[model samples]
Target: MPVGLSMRLISLLIVFLLLLPSTEMKRPGKGKGLKGARQNLAPGRVRVAGRHSRSRSSRLVRLPNCSESTESGEVFVDCQDQRLTSIPASQMWLKEPKHLLLARNRIRVLNDMAFRGYESLTSLDLQQNQISLVEEGAFQGLTSLTTLLLQHNRLVTLSEEALIPMPSLRYLRLYDNPWNCFCPLDSLIRTIQVPSNRKLGNHARCAEPITLKGIKLKQVDPELLCKESDPTGDPMEDQRDSTNTLKPSPIRSKPDAIAACHTYFFPQMRMDCRKQGLTEVPTGIPEDIVHIDLSHNSISHLKARDFQGARSLRTLNISNNNMEHIDTGSLAGLLHLRELDLSDNSLLFIQYGVLEDLYFLSQLNLGGNPWMCNYSIHYMVYWLRLHPAVRHSGLLCHSPLEHNGESVEEYVNSYNRECPKDRQHSQIDQDTDPELWQTVMEVQREVEEELEPSHLKAPQKYQIIRLS
Candidate 1:
């Protein structure tokens, strides 16, 4: 009777075993598959080589202050001011971030491989950091970078090769650093002067060599930086020996003076001494000369008595000279002088009151001078503003990065004279109407011509004849 019951139970067990699921079915959701393993792990967990499993929170977590976004299969990172002392190597995971902002941090030095593989980076901001040294090739792979901001850092100098990789870089901010303007900085100065380097203000200023401090790198004469070989003779002995041999010689005869300079007696005694390579003003010129063209020479200084005999001189062309200093009273006796051309000179400083006596001065050209546009040049700005007829367009500032490429008029207008504690006076009033000054100058010329000799005055087409 039990044989049938045992046989039915065996059949039920076999059916139950057949209905149970196989091991392959359990493997899908049991943390064996890739998706299952990922889901089983906790959020922000990462497995690093040769280290125990750790959560990202254990390390410096990049907060929302730093952000990332995926666009066009590339990630862009913004990690600005996250108190980051060094750039995270994890950025390599991005392959090549298109935009990175690491500015306003405490990054003291950038290693050579800082951006080794970030070739797709188009913009980078490292401004307002403590980056004193950027190792060569630090930005080697940033071929697509168009903008870089490194302003307000401690960088004293950078090799030309550091920027060679960034051929596409169009904008750079490198001001507000203590730049030593020695020979190494000449290349950078020339680079900034390139027209394509737009918005980069004048080259950095020199902070060393007390004599050159506060001077723009572009303004320093290249010859001043040259290292001359030691002279074979004792400098003092050579000077004394030469002085002993020098004796007062007789003055040049009148014929010799005229022969030295190309002169003309006709057309109101015009003297064309231009391009003669003369270092000093020629002596023994006729007193009746009205125009003296001594331009394009190598004159470096002008004494007060240079033109004492040329009191009747109405025009003096001294352009393209190397004149650095002119005595205060150099132009005093030229009462009739109306036009004076002193353009294209290497003048660094012009003594005050040098132009005070030129009351009838109508035209003055002071362009192409490496003017030190600082507090000391306040008087010159004030004078130019007072007389708008002066050619102010060509008066570009060569110093003070903030005022680079700015005209003298624009600089004077924007300059804050009150910024200097020692400044005694406030900014001069620049509201003088240029048109009104032009009218006054025209009237003054008419009055001066009436006082001149009839032969010196312009010929009139008609004359007034009165018979009584």
Candidate 2:
């Protein structure tokens, strides 16, 4: 009896173990479902870098966040504003891409053999990047490339060997960089200055050796650049690595003004760059901008043609800044300007011809400034006198103890009585209205004749009259 019972118990235990294994297999696995949920591998959605243990094949697909599109039967890979550190050509370039745009990235160097397989590419945009070094063989395999944009970088010069590979290249942009204007830049400058390369380096200018600063590469004489050695010695600038062919200058290439500043289309086409700490006015402002607020900055001077492109601007606020001087013709293009603010600045006076371009200006704010009521201040007052319709204020004296705390108008009146200026100056000279002055003189003569001839001569009195 004991043997039979023990044998039956062992048979029941084997059956129970087999049933448990089959039951677990038939039921759904929770871990597998959660893994798929975390990846979210849905179709038509863009994928980002993931923390999952990737396969060897997937590691080669670490491309920038891009959205593919087709135009004119050509494939375009736009990776703008991706915060990318390197070009996507070597990592995940398409087979037959015609355009590979990587604008506004953080790419700082272009090593040799960079775009090895990009032979079919026609246009490559590298503008608005922080690229400092571009080795000689960087464009080795780009035989079909036509357009290359390198504006807004930190390149002091470019080697001519880099251009030898790109024979089919036609359009190039190298503006907005701090060009060193030294011996190494001679070959590149001479190449681009040729009439055949008209569109190559249009607006690129030198930034070092103060004499050559602000001079365009096209206008510079290539023969003279290398003719003189380091006459000025090494430039007093940030020291760079000695191994580089061309020194990487300080990054002064300004970003796109429309992108750096805030733009609003509704109500009015305006750009608000208030408190941006801009030392100089940025270029490439949209031509359609109507109002611009550049107040609360560190701009100490306004260069000539600063507002050259903003022809449609109506209101300009440059108040609350360190503006001490505005070059002649600085505001040369604002033909439609209606209002301007110069309040709360370090200006002692306004120079002549600075406001000559604002033909239709109506309101001008000059408050909160320390205007010195000197002879140089006459141009501003004369301009206001001619444009009587312009509503303006803040013309007060802040120096010359005798004229301090007095309105500029009162000081002008006193100065005219004491030390008069010429009539052509638009000053309120008595000679402007000859009839009025002649009548006063005749009345005084008649009074003198009646008093002195009849009895004792009484002293004639004349009152100083003020005119605008």
Candidate 3:
């Protein structure tokens, strides 16, 4: 009605009409999120719309700009050996990327929608990183993704929802992760059954529940994994072992019995020289043994001679031993070794060539040892870089100066001081020694002294009656 108000209204209407065209535009082609993008359909390809980022300083490594017209090829996105803390949100541009490589970085978090636009991504390699917390929805948009490589990272818990998507995902590699022993991890272990159930039969079990206590997770009742009040309410009840039966045992350690009969049951018999007071390696490991656990022993030094008989050993765990240093010669015997866990020992040093013979070795664990972590130790990091095939897991801070209060990732990337200045040789600290075999022997001796000689006598043989 008024002249000035009519002019202002006309100007506003013009601006609104101009904005309508931009909003009505159709969704652009894959990989190109910009306003104007030409559609070109092709396998393993998509094009980025915005300016291609060329900055080397961005922590997030991005795949090459794929176009809708491109063909199948390995989409290289190697930001592996960098100091990244998380997968950047900007990586959503690769809508149809085939391969995404982010190995050997310092990534600690994997947030929700981390791969928002990667709907057609097939293979993802996140081999070696410091990923500790992978929040739910970390892989929200990956639908066609098949192969996922998360072999070596500091993942304590894996939320079930984190992997509920991607039904096409197979060949999941989570071999060398330091998984926390808790109820939250039940879903992950159960998921493994879907892949390896027919092969493992009904005997496969989780090896550890508490970190060092070595309680078999399988032996613990399924009810234990659940909160006493809300077990069935949880969906993981289907994964619980249904066979609640136990094998019958004939012997019982009773005072009235003349002799005590002990029976040991293992998935497979192996050289378990733990606290046995044996100076030499045991001789009776089964030929088909796949996992060998020799932890918590007084093994002062290990040589190739010790493993001469083990040919099928794949997973060798020699943690909490008295090893000061290891040579290439010592590990040359384990040609088939895939996972070598030598944590919590007195290993002050490791020669450059120590792991040279292990070509098939996929995982190496050397955490909790007293490493110098100074300039001289730079070669260790460099060596890790050289062997891309061998998964580095998370780097452990063996010294307080390098990682007193920092995380395992912080020590590996930036805080590693690399073998401190040359100093005089210091005697090994007694507190750090892993020689607990003598203590075990002493305890056995005391038990013997407390028993009467009559108790040591043999028990009368019982008649065997086989039930039909």
Candidate 4:
């Protein structure tokens, strides 16, 4: 066709030939043997890369002084009471230990990755230490950890981030620490109170902010804790953590019924709630509880059915309180009660039927109370006479113009002498129980005073009995 056109086509063909080699080189898996082997080697390289982490973990510093032993084909490191100031190098264990006991040590602060390389730890005991601060991710690499004992430490607050590493955690002892009961403690308290975490945080109590002092961690109302944190407050500063990465998860609200008390099964079932600053009788006493000590409190009144759930209760100590009134049926269903201590109180007189449920009660302590020596005090005397086998003390009169400082028994005799036999028989026949409806003793006293000046007898329907 044309000599110039042929030469242009040949030059284009040469450029195309040069581009062909570049294109071929970019094709994936182009070589049948060498490239295919490289593809096969890729997976091995990835597996080797994955193993590098384990190798690095193994290269950690060693603790040559750590005591080691074998149990059930698993390694155990017992460094408890070693007076350790900090956690030793975790790579001391060739194989991750099953149990690591660092209890009763002097370890104070647990930083992030504190227990790294202890991936197989099932139980870790750090109890009775001075550890007050736990940074987030402090328990990293403890994936199989189950039982963690942090009790008797100085931990005031712990982030949920520290707990996230131990998914298998079950039993956790966090008692005896001075836990600051405030908004900062919400997440940790909630984690300890989950229904599945029943054995966790048993007997842990607050040690600060007077109002919540001595209150159990489980019973301290979370809503009360969230009482509008000051906007000006730096929560991170309040948490006392420099690296505060905790994003507060949704806290759940639960209805708590367990009393803020310490329960014991050894020797015998007992509930001790002394000096707890209680305003009233605590609810939810366990039915199987045999003894309960509630002295040294601020309980001003005992409501009816307060101890109804404690059917098996044999002994109760409620002295050293502000109790002034014992409502009817307060002691109901206490058929097995054998001992009761009601001393050191503000009680003037116990109402009728208040102690009728203690069929087996053999010991009664009513000392240290301001016992009134009036007609309203007759029920207490009558009960004591009927329960002749009961050993009791502190029945002296504390009031009334003539009966002041006299024995309660003497006041009862004077009352019986003044009460007319005919009128007493008639009243007893008319009323099934003298205090059947439990009229207020103060009302009866007021009626007696109102009737005396006019010398008018009480109406037949009224239950006022005047001493002639």
Candidate 5:
């Protein structure tokens, strides 16, 4: 070999030796690296790694401040006072929680799936929250829920379907909330009033309609509370007419049937006072009488205290009589009254709220009466329209030549179409007689004064005033 070639090879060898340490350092170690690679390549090890990652992610997404525990195979969650505006999504993972305490929170509207996951929940305490507007089916999954404390919440109305899912619910605390006592609440009231059901808390009272202030929810008359008048005109204007010269017919001689007033005890206690020529409601009627028939009589007026003695009266018949006026409170005490017959009478006007106290009145016969077609009759029309259960057949209009013989429903529709703007004021044009118009205006002013808060004096004595 030549001397230069030997020197170049020696330099190459030195360079190779210099890179040897770095190459070995860059390569993976024999034991640790190979073992790790083998383990990662295995299917079981890969699944374990993926599961660990998922477990770590799930643990990180825990509900803040919500604590849960198991006792006797039942889970109990305590998320109370968490300042939660809604139910935490993490709660959906709870398995058959038996008790859930979410009281003293800031929860507002309870959506339909608010408590969806808690199907086995037996007790739920939602008191002292800002909850309002519980959507239908909010408690859909709470089939096992028995105790529900909804007191001290902002709930205004709850529909019948809202509680249909919780068949096991026995104890319910509903109090300290503003409740609107109206027709929609009738079924709820009936449900809560059941003897076996939980008692409605004392704070459950009317929160609207100044007239019904402080009235207890249990004591509220569902029928009377549901009666609503027209929002536009006075309901009493319909009966005002030019017949101010007509007077109520005087009572004639009593019929011999008065001596044979039959009393029944079967099915229900009832008194038959029909065709006895009764000038007025007969006295000495038993307080336990459930029904009374005084049809075909000469009774001209129904005084305020006429039915005061028959508080238990369920049905009253005064048809085919000379009835001209019915004073307010005349049927006040008939709380359970279901049917009333005032058909074929000479009624010109029906005082507003006169039948308001007949809370359970299901059937009313105003047929064959001389109903005046004006703004005053708006209340009756509105009431009849609102309550389809009210039997109002044959309610014909007797005045206004254009609407005469027309049903009250047809007359109302015509009135709304023709005199939509100023029907109340049009009464003056309907009656050209200034005297009659003046009388109506004076009567209207008197009624307004009577309705004033300051003028709420004792009811005046019943008077036999002429309706001419």
Candidate 6:
């Protein structure tokens, strides 16, 4: 009887032990479900690293609290397309994100210390926003930043000392800003004249004086301010008459006469007329000219006839000359041309839609010319970005913004300042009409030539007169 009772007790004990193993297995599954529910409640936590430990194949480590403070060099913040208005200040607490993109948002102002405390940040993108103002010291603490993009904004003026703290900053973009062409923007204009630097604009003319339109800042003569129409006589008055008579005026020169050169040269033309001091665009470039180089000359203006007959022309270079403007009708026939260069000259303004006809053009050289960072310059910036195939070489900004005061390349990049519209409109002289205003700017530029800081000496006899 005792042995039977013992066996029955032992059987009961074995049954309970077996049930315990099954219950333990069931608890793990139940815990998993609860954990999954918690994860659903905190989606941002799932985005953190290590939550996807099940996927051993994925190497991307989730960052701990994207907005939380981190120990340097541990994470990345991809806030692109998030429709953000301002970058959350908590980002400064992140442990050195390698890349931070804040593109496509409504960010308007970038305050000082906007990106403070993150020492290991390398790349930052603030492109495609409505950013209009950038306070001084905005980019102060980003020492490791290499590439900074701020394209497509409404910047009008940049102080000289704005970008002094960004020593590691390499690529800076302030394109597509409505730069106000005025005295306030002169420093920014001078900043873009450095090497590896580029800008997108036609010219930086004086917006205050009617006579300074289309005149590049490099060509501006502060002395012209003293040359207000002399009571005795104007020195440039006779120079103007001489210059006009030398050219078969744009209106007087027949389109056919210009086309005559096109017929003689036929499909392939190579005319050597360099250093001739020629004062006008050569007539009759062949309709199918493959290459036409008229460099190192004294040509002062560009007319519609310049490229009228060149239907199949591929390359045209007009460098090292004095040109004040790029008319809309000029170079209208370059349908198949791939390369065009206009460098080292005096260009005051690049009118809107002037290069609208260049469809297949791939390479465009416009360096060694003054590029003003003003509102009137936005047209060129927008156009260049629209056509990716077209390459701009030797482009430099002559503005002196305090942020990028020493660097020239930073001028073309995205920034929060630009030149003004009054610099292009609202003529600086007494004449209010557009035509007369244009004339005043032109004449004033010449009057101020004596004030230019070049090796060429100005005539000492000329009395002081203000061009404005």
TM-score of each: 0.37, 0.43, 0.35, 0.45, 0.37, 0.33
Q: Which stretches of candidate 4 lie over 4 Å from their true place?
A: 1-153, 156-197, 202-265, 420-468
Model 2: how far is 182 from its true place, Å? 0.4
lDDT by residue (tens digit), candidate 5, 1-468: 999999999999999999998787677763355455556463312222231244522222335486678866777778777897887653344354678878779987888878865777788878779887888778887888887777677876777678888888886767666777666776777767666765434336666544454455665555564565457643212222321222222343333221335544323567777777678776556678898898998899888777766788888999999899998888888888899999999987678878777767789888888888888777777666556676756678889887889887787777656643356567568647887876776775554443345656566576436677
- What lDDT would candidate 3 get against the real structure? 0.56
Q: Best candidate per TM-score, number?
A: 4
* Tens-digit per-residue lDDT, 353-389, candidate 1: 7887776777887888887777666666656555656
Scored against the true structure, residue 248 in model 4 reaches a CA lDDT of 24
List ranges where model 6 is wrong by over 4 Å.
Answer: 1-40, 44-76, 89-95, 195-468
- Which of the predicted structures, 3 or 4, would earn the higher TM-score when compared with the native? 4
List of clashing residue pairs for candidate 4: none
Q: Pairs clashing in candidate 2?
A: none
Worst 10 residues of 6 by lDDT: 258-267
lDDT of 4 by residue, 35-98 (tens): 4544555321311213224652222232435677886687778886678898876545545678
Which of candidates 2 and 5 is the stronger one according to lDDT? 2
Which wins on TM-score, candidate 1 or candidate 6?
1
Which of 3 and 5 is the better model by lDDT?
5
* Per-model lDDT: 0.66, 0.76, 0.56, 0.75, 0.69, 0.59
Query: On lDDT, who's better, 1 or 3?
Result: 1
**Ten residues in sequence with the least summed lDDT for candidate 4:** 43-52
**Candidate rank order under TM-score:** 4, 2, 5, 1, 3, 6
